[model samples]
Target: MEHKPLDQLRSVADVQPRPLSREERLQRWIDLLETDPKRRLSSLGEIEYKPPAERALLREDDSPLTVAYEDPVLRADGLSSDRLGDAMRYFALSDGQAHYALCSCLSGRTMEAGTCAQRLRNATGNVAWESAVGAWLLAALAVSLPGLVYLLS
Candidate 1:
C-alpha cells in the first residue's frame, strides 16, 4: 500500500464545512477593518484612508499650522489647522486633479487660490455659500470692469 496526501485521500467538501452566515461575514469584515491599523479609521472617522507616503507631507516649518497660523490665505477659506488635516485626508482619497489643486493652493499660488479652492470644494462636496457669492461678485466685476473703464475714460 502507498501512503497518499490527505487531499488525495479524501474530498474535504464531502465533510460539509459550515458556510459563513450573513451576520458572520459582516462581522468578519468589521473585525478586519477594526484590527487593521492601516485600514482603521483615523480621528477624522473617514473610511477611506491613505498611507503616510501618499498624504501631503508638510514639514514642521512649512506646515500651515505653524507658518500659516496667522496668515489669512488658508484661514480666509475656512481651512484652519483644525480642518486642514481633514482636507488633506480628503485630498488623499480624491483624484490627482484635486490633489494638484490642493498643492497649488497650499504652496501659495495666490492667483490660482480661488480656482484651486473651488476644485477642492467640488471634490469634498462642501462648497460654501461664500465661495459662490464671491465667484458671482468676481464675475460681475470682470464683466463690468471694461465698460466701467470705458465710461470713465
Candidate 2:
C-alpha cells in the first residue's frame, strides 16, 4: 500500500484563509487610487512617493504613478548640494532655463522659479507659492546702487 500525504488524505487544519468583504475590498481600492505628492528641497535626492497604503489601484490594488514623456516634476538631474555651483551658474547666466519648477495647479497661483523648478512642476503645472529669487536680486542691485553713486560722486 502506498502512503498518501497526510495533508491530502486527512483533514488537516493547518492553513486558514479568509476572503475580504465587498465593502472592505472597495475601500482598499479607493485608498490605492488616491495619491499625495509633496516637494522636498535640500541636499538630498528628490522623489515622488505613492506612500504606504492598504489599498491598490482598483478595488484590489494601487496603481503605479505615471511619469509624462516630458514631466518637469520628475526631473532626474543632480539635485545634490554638489550641483549647487551649476545651479548658481544657471541662475546667473540664464534668464530661467536650467533649474526645475514646482507648482500646485489647484491653488490658482503659479511658481516661476528656475528651469529645475519648472521641471519639478511638470513644466505646465501651477503652484500656490510663487517665489522668485531674481526679483530679490534686482532689488538688491537697486538698493545698493544709490549708495555706490553717493560714495563715488
Candidate 3:
C-alpha cells in the first residue's frame, strides 16, 4: 500500500463531521418526518433565526413521553433510525421504560395504559407490570410537577 502524502492526510476531526448542535439535530428529525418539502426547508431557516439559547432548548422537555409524542412522524422516524440512541438519551427513561415505550411507539404512537401494560410484558420480561405502571406514573408526575407545586404552594 502506498503511503499518503502529508497534503493528503486528514485529521480525525476533519474526517468525522462535527456533532450537530441540539437545534440542528432536532431540525434533522423534523426533516425526516415532514412530508412537505417546503415546510421542511422553511423550518431550517426558522431555526437559524432563533437565538442560540432558545434554539438549544427547542428540544428540551422534562417529560420524555411529552417529547416522544410531540410529533408522531418524528417519534416514529427516531424510533426506527440510529437516532433511537439520541432519543433514548434525551428522554432519560430507565432501560425498562425506554424499551417498553420504544416497543409501543414502534408498534403505534400511542402508549395508552392498556397497550403499555401489554407491551411492557412483551418487551421487559418479568415484573413488567410495575415497571410499566411506574413509567406511566413518573411520566405523569414529570408533566404535572410544576402545576402540582403551584397548586400546593
Candidate 4:
C-alpha cells in the first residue's frame, strides 16, 4: 500500500528572527563604508550622476571624485579635496537619494543636488554618527552658491 504524504507544516508565529542591536547596526554601516568604492557603489545601487539641463556637460575625463574637486562652482563654495573625500565616503555608505545628491553635487547639477540635500535631511534620525555625517554634508553644501540658492528658494 502507498503511504500517505505528511500534511503541510504550519509556520511558527512566535519564531521571529531577532532584530539587530544598535551596536551591530553601526558596526555593519562602518563595515560597509570601509569596503572598496566600486563594491560599495554597487551595493548601494550603482548610482550614476547625470548632469542637469541647465549645467554645462561633463567632460570625458570627469569622474565623481574629479568632478567634486575640479568644478569651479564647488571650488568657489570651498569644497576641499579632504571634505569631498569625506562626503564621497559617507555617500557611498548612504542610501539611494543621498548617493544621487552626492553624485549630482559632484556633477555640478544644482537642482538635483538640492533635492539630494533635502533627502539627506529627511533621513537624519536615531543613528548618531550618520546624523553627524549628514549634518556635516549639509553644512558643506550650504556654503556653495547653488546650495545657498537652493536653501533660499
What TM-score would each prediction reach against the true structure? 0.24, 0.23, 0.24, 0.22
In the range 45-146, model 3's lDDT, one tens digit per residue, is 133345645533333221233333455554444433223344545433355454543342344433333343344334434466677899999999999999
Which stretches of model 4 miss by more than 4 angstroms?
1-85, 90-97, 103-109, 112-114, 124-153
**How do all the candidates rank in terms of TM-score, highest first?**
1, 3, 2, 4
lDDT of each: 0.40, 0.30, 0.43, 0.39
For model 2 the TM-score comes to 0.23
The collision pairs in model 1 are none
Candidate 1 lDDT over 7-88, as tens digits, reads 8656644533355443343233223333332321112111124454444433233222232243443334333453335434
- Each candidate: how many clashes? 0, 25, 0, 0
Per-residue lDDT of candidate 2, residues 52-123 (tens digit): 131111110111112111223222322112132332232221212112231122222322222223353333
Window of ten residues with lowest summed lDDT in model 3: 37-46
How many clashing residue pairs are found in candidate 1?
0
Q: Give a tens-digit lDDT track for model 4, residues 2-55.
A: 544334222423343355443343233333333333321211212343433212
TM-score of candidate 1 relative to the true fold: 0.24
Clashing pairs in 3: none
- lDDT (Cα) of model 4: 0.39
Two-way lDDT contest, 2 vs 3, winner: 3
* Clashing residue pairs, backbone N/CA/C < 3 A, model 4: none
Q: Looking at candidate 1, what is the lDDT of residue 53?
A: 48
